[model samples]
Target: MAATLRNLKIKTSTCKRIVKELHSYEKEVERESAKTADMKAKGADPYDLKQQENVLAESRMMIPDCHKRLEAALTDLKGTLVEIEEELNQKEGPEFEEAQKVITEVEQVLQSTEA
Candidate 1:
């Protein structure tokens, strides 16, 4: 049970990293989109616009998959917390309390992402 909990902690950490990286990617996409629009308004070359369009298209495709993965990771984290709580016989110990705090934080992040 200890090992399983440790693994779940590691997974949760990784998921957090993934969420951070995806947010960075999203910011980059937004910058690129704005640049693309600026170039279009300035009558930039078709080749440049096409390249930017392709990048935006690719980002649009990947962002949803990233969201899905993040959601799955959050679900896994919640499930692991439940298992750990069950293993501990639902005792109100420090570990369970910490887990609940982490779960709440994760849920907040998930909610922000959805918004």
Candidate 2:
């Protein structure tokens, strides 16, 4: 029971952190893209534009990897939940609720990406 609760806490934190990381990566890509666009609009040097494009591309690449990590983390959480569902019913607490919330939030994130 203690182990299950600990797993729930850790998985919850992991999922939440992944969500934040994914959002940060997306914002970084957006910011870099805007910079690249602005540089083009300003007729920035070709070499500088290429470098900014590279940065933007790198940022864009991270997003897919982050999404994969998020999916894996969600799966891990779900598996943990399934392992302890009987225990969870007998020992519902804030940690369990938090885990459920994170699962829903991650699913929403995944759904939005699909759309």
TM-score list, all predictions = 0.80, 0.94
Q: Each prediction's Cα lDDT score?
A: 0.74, 0.90
- In angstroms, what RMSD does candidate 1 have relative to the true structure? 2.5
Predicted model with the maximum lDDT:
2
- Residue-level lDDT of model 2, residues 16-68, one tens digit each, is 99999999998998899899999999999999999999999999899899999
State the displacement of the C-alpha of residue 114, model 1, in Å, after optimal TM-score superposition: 3.3
Q: Give the 10-residue window scoring lowest on summed lDDT in candidate 1.
A: 90-99
Residue pairs clashing in model 1 are none
**RMSD of candidates 1 onward, in order:** 2.5, 1.3
Candidate 2 regions with alpha-carbon error over 4 angstroms? 87-91
Tell me the tens digit of each residue's lDDT in model 1 across 1-115: 6776675667667577767867877887898889889999999999989999998888767777787887787788778777776875653555556556666776776677676
| Model 1: per-residue Cα lDDT at residue 105 | 71
Best by TM-score: 2
